[model samples]
Target chain A: MKATHIQLAHGNGGRLMRELLETLVFPALGCREAFTDASPLASDKRIPLMASDSFTVQPLEFPGGNIGSLAVHGTLNDLAVSGAEPAALTLNLIIEEGFALDTLRRLLESAGAAARAAGVPIIGGDTKVVPRGQGSGLVIASTGLGWRDAGCALDIRSVQPGDAVLVSGPLGDHGASVLMAREAFGLSSGLQSDASCVLELAHAVRDLPGLRFMRDPTRGGLASVLHEILQASGCGCELNEAVIPLRPEVSGVCQLLGFNPLQLACEGRIVAIVAVESANEVLARWQALPEGQSATRIGHLTVDRRVILRTPLGGQRYLDELAEDPLPRIC
Target chain B: MKATHIQLAHGNGGRLMRELLETLVFPALGCREAFTDASPLASDKRIPLMASDSFTVQPLEFPGGNIGSLAVHGTLNDLAVSGAEPAALTLNLIIEEGFALDTLRRLLESAGAAARAAGVPIIGGDTKVVPRGQGSGLVIASTGLGWRDAGCALDIRSVQPGDAVLVSGPLGDHGASVLMAREAFGLSSGLQSDASCVLELAHAVRDLPGLRFMRDPTRGGLASVLHEILQASGCGCELNEAVIPLRPEVSGVCQLLGFNPLQLACEGRIVAIVAVESANEVLARWQALPEGQSATRIGHLTVDRRVILRTPLGGQRYLDELAEDPLPRIC
Candidate 1:
């Protein structure tokens, strides 16, 4: 028989769920704790960081990814930005009745591989089945626990004028791909999800002496992230649109959707701040990776506490926080 | 002005949710780490026994309980059964759109107070707003981490056939109350919910060397607890139905609903096993507490490998594992 696809049955504590975990996910994630109720996390000598997030994207499965990989990536990113080495994660699934088993398996396969790439193990997890109509498709919640290398935390409040802002990859790819699959505004495009792990990028450059701050732009998008940093760091920021990287296709989608590219969500990307002298070193390290070839210097910290955007026509205007929700039900 | 009921605004990050936690819960459970994104737990000589549970009962507030108290009790019991000393807990709320602010505040107050009463603190928590059609009132997920005390464990595998079965307080109260509220199975009795914290009761019997196992009957009711013990210990059970304690009103509700009292749920009660020599002492300790006043000698463990019920008719019948879904969404 061929693969049956993911269903609620695969989540049940039966043969199907067992086989899926053992065959696909276990090898990728080191398979030690994925089946347990929870990963045993103990704080060692270093300060530990833990974060929990829930993914509620619609359609369960989407182009360039499904809910599974996104769940792993979303959580790993949270831990990475906090300057911690993600140790283990707990994946809990709330599956609606009658969900296809084959789809679930494929999602788990991708999720496990993503966790492995991030150098973290998917330890303990739980599965609960809700009756049909009570819940739709599936809702996945992942909680991550990581250890912060002592004295290596980047202070978000310590960012100062003349600090350089950097992006590890192009922006808006994730949101664009999701909208393409969702058929929102009657638009369809062949865009894949950019859901990949970023633990390596975080670890590789984490030890930089001049590093000031870092964050993963998820909900509220890049524009919101910038605004948050300004407000939090008590500093101003200025961006050069020409230098900021964006996929041509993503730009097109944003234009038609009347959405700002910077306000569009990105699943697997990083924004780092560093001293001007170390900016070249950090950029070099990021661009060396396959996922971060487009890493660019997008902006610079300003003494004035305002966010200014350089328009395509070389005009300058303050870019305020987006007043509207860009996307809901996003991981 | 008269007090208003629960409104959707309460679950918002604004005033209602804050007042609920600040006024009701924080005062009782303490203020530290209550508002943080995650509750940080520390340990020394004692190992933490972590457990989590979700409650989705239909009515937000029941006769003798509400979702708040249930979340606290459910989590503490999980730790208790593992023979751990209850320490701290995290409470996560998934509030549906339009949930009343007043109602949520009241519920949190109750939940917070309940945790304090159990000597447990509501540490970390999360809140999400789902669309109206997506949820029923609200769902609460509580994760509790407890410290294990020396000589406080009851390993099921070591249980022997001569061990005796006992129960602290009555069964069927919570289950009967749910039926009365649901108005299902032609039952509309005004039975009260038996939701209560069992931490004290669990601790009282922790030092009993004869303690073999303990469990609280909730979803599948009292019968399922017995089944779990029998399976884990590889022993049979013989239950004396005549001696199994039940409230008169709860028994009436069960009869009207065409359900057996033995198959009903009990949130605050416990099913315990001990060596016969210590059974009387354990029972006496249980009877002294107000919550354990209705405790009884419910059954015994046997090598027969079959669960049997001794009926009031002087006849014997199989006490099969409860297969019928007695009640749904009872945490």
Candidate 2:
């Protein structure tokens, strides 16, 4: 008989755990052979880049994606934005006892597919089961190993006073999509989370000689990324609010819930800094990708160390660092 | 006012999260500079090894070590046993909302100390917070990156019928200590978890000409490791029960609780297989280390496909794969 749900024994590192991994995990994740404690990685000549992230989104299954695919993309994007080509990924799963085995299978398969799509292999991983009630269904922590391009030099210190600020696409779609999935406010929208790998968008701009740095606007959205730039580069940003791309559905949710669209998350977007001379080229390359159809230059770095937004009505307002929790587990 | 417990806003990746990381995490973990999402690793000429594990032990703190230290040792040991020198580590923390801030600080500091002791730097990491009542206070996942020794060629397939099996130290101290810490059975003992880095022990014998393989007996302990060898090498094991290292305190706990000492966990022990000609040198080298004072040859590989234990009374019994979990979250 097959176990319908996870058991404590399944994490005991005994027969049951072996059975669970061999029958479900290995097959779902496309593991070709039984893994030892640690696996050896192929040698790479280029400098190595490593990034790790833990995914704890509520309602494990959200619109457009689940925690599985989100985990892969989140970690991969960190490397992607750092001007590195992802080499491999390691997954760590913390499962709650009594969680449905079928659900676990689906998530693993989804993660496998996402990795395959991105051309990275899931080389090694570990799993543990906590007693029921001590955990929320599951949490996945993924670490990505990548190889940086030999000639690429990207850093926040390179940002200058007149550098342009650009975004790969519309912001806040992911935050809005997850909010509607919760159904806490009885709101509905056709919005889907823009949770995806930003590898292509990053690769497109990585070779640009004038590129300063690129960051994925995730948890705290565009506002957070802007604040980070102010702190790291000693350069503030002046945004043209009218030109910043945003979806109508995402803006509607923010208006109704008293949330700032700029403070909402967008998993599939990139905030990049580049010299004014090369800004148009960066925009052109990004716009060529389907994921970046809405790419736009929304702002520019300023001499003053304060993030200021110019409203369409010619009103100027300072954008402070995000100070409150708009949504928990938005990632 | 200082917050005494974690809040959802601390994970929002905004002001609160930045403060939490800067004021607590960075200083405690010896991070000299603010970290970007992904950190570049120095290139290593040798083959790289990767391993990952999640620690979900109950009680958070045990008799001899806390989850933080355990997390470091567990992942590093995996790499060490694979004949790799630890290079770097990545930490992932999943904190429950309302978890005590002081506790978090202590764990991070302990983890930092452990990493420092092992001479491994934490290059990158991530943190996420879950809603209250949805997590068991804290769970830590660690991933280790290592460089394999150039001449080391360790694999289970290297074992043959004449290979001798040796254990570095007594078994079950970790399991017994954690079990007693729970106080579920109102039992007490002086047992302390033997949790520490096994790098020196592994290094001492990793280059032995006849060394077949090495494994750290963790979750399913000695019995499970032997079973794995049997399955992978297509060779069984013949163990002499009288010579196996068993601490009196651990044996007492197992006897009173109807547990099998051979099947309980040990955090800092190694089980090695070597050609009979090299077994004495391996045991001698290991016994010189404080962590391996009780090192002894316990068994030898057999032609038959069965794990047979020779009893002190001249009777023999088959050691079957562990089916039931004696204790959950023992690691």
Candidate 3:
């Protein structure tokens, strides 16, 4: 009889572990190499870039994506935003013993599909199982290797006064959707998480000569990314609140929950800084893509080192870095 | 006034997370980059090699090392045994909310020390916090990028019948020592884990003209590595029980627990297959290193596809791939 749940033996690095990898892991990840210590990465001439992230989203599976897809997108997005084309990825799964095998398979398949869609292969991986109660159902850590395009330079230091700020899509959907899924507040929403690869959004503006920097607003959302920009460039940001895209469902939940949408996570959104001269071109390119249909120019860099939001009422408010934990394990 | 334990806020990608990284993680890991989405890998001409591993060792701290050091050694050793020179590493830390910050500091410092000792830089990383009870103290997933040696052509396909099998040091110390630390069975011992980088041993034999393959006998110990070799090369291993190196403490623990030392884990050891003519040369080189003083020729590859163990009494028994879990999270 096949075990329906993971056992301690499945991580013993013996027959069961081998069987698990060969039967489920390898096939799901599209890996052809038999178990080996390490894999040889294809040699490339472009400068190499690297990024890593860990996904601990609660409930494992959310509306539009699960921890597996989030893990892939999260790491790959980091590389993408850095103006690099992802070349390969390495995954590490820490599974809790007694977790359902069916669920594990589903997550692995999602991860594989995400990687395939991104055109990046997961070439190496490791699996370890913890005692049942010692771990959440599962946590995936991913590392991405990419090749930086020649002649492209993206750095926070490049941001100067008057640089424009743009976002790829709606904010707070991921965080709000996850919170809704948890049902801690007895609220339900039709909103789906925006967890997805932002590679296309990145590629759309990567060649813009006036592009200064790009970042994916994740855990701490757009507000946090703006704070990073302020710290890095010694410049302030002035945002038009009415222009920042936010879904009605997300805003409704945030208002009820007293959470700031700007401070909430957006797994699939990109916040970019471009010179005023090239902002329209960047916006046009992004708005043409399905992932960036709602892309908008939200604000611009200021000489002063403060993040300010121009409300619809014509009042200005300082946007501070997030301090409290609004929701845990949203991504 | 200060929280001595980790909080969910520390992983929120906000002020708390920034302070945590600046005050604890960055300094401990010798990271200087202020939080960027990704890092740039130094361009190199050598072929890149990638490997990843997660460490969930129980007790968090064991006799010779903690999870932090173990994570570094485990991932680096994977690359080393694959004939790659250590280069850079990425770390993903998943801390249980309420875990002691002091303990986390010690582990991070140990990880930094290990990387420094191995001359590898941890260039990129991420941190996530899980709800307290949903996690063991902490789990570290590390991915390593390395440069393969210029002329090294190591692969299992090169292994042939009559090849000499060698081990760099005693087996099961890591697993037994961790078991002792757990004190789950009220048993104690002075055994210390042999968890360290095997790069020196790998480098010593990598240039040999007849070297067929090299592997780190880690999670499944020497026996499992032999099984992998058997499966990959269509060859079997014939080991002389008396000739294999074993520590008295480890053997004592295994005997008391009815565990096969051969099936236990070794955090830092090498199992290599070399041409019979070059075995003595490889042994000499390994024995010269302090880490490999106990290096021994434990076995030879056999044409018959059956792993056999020759006992001191001139009788033999088949050493099957491990089927049961003797311990969990030893690595």
- Model 3 per-residue lDDT at B291: 96
Give the local distance difference test score of model 3.
0.89
TM-score of each: 0.82, 0.98, 0.98
Candidate 3, residues A155-233, lDDT tens digits: the string is 9888999999999899989999998998777787679999999999998889888999999999899988998888877
In the range B120-217, model 1's lDDT, one tens digit per residue, is: 76655555555566656667766666666645557767788978999998787886786677665564556788888787788788888888878777
By the TM-score metric, which is better: model 1 or model 3? 3
Interface RMS for model 2: 1.1
- C-alpha DockQ of every model: 0.19, 0.82, 0.84
lDDT of 2 by residue, A1-331 (tens): 2899999888898999989989998888877777678877777688877788999988888888989999999999999999999988899999999999999999999888889999998888888899999999999999888889667789988899999999999999998899889868887777899999999999888998999999999888899999999899899999999999999999888898888989888888899999999999999999999998899999999999999999999999988777768699887
Window of ten residues with lowest summed lDDT in model 3 chain B: B34-43
Error of 3 at A245 (Å): 0.6
Q: What overall lDDT goes with each candidate model?
A: 0.70, 0.90, 0.89
lDDT of 3 by residue, B1-331 (tens): 1779999899999999988998999899877776467777777678988899999998899899999999999999999989998788999999999999999999999999999999999998899999889988889999899888667789988999999999999998998999999867887777899989888888887888988898888888887988988888789989999988999998998888888899889999988899999999999999999999999999899999999999999999998888778788888
Q: What is candidate 2's TM-score against the reference?
A: 0.98
Badly placed stretches (over 4 Å) of model 2 are none
Chain B TM-score of candidate 1 stands at 0.89
Model 3 spans > 4 angstroms off: B184-186
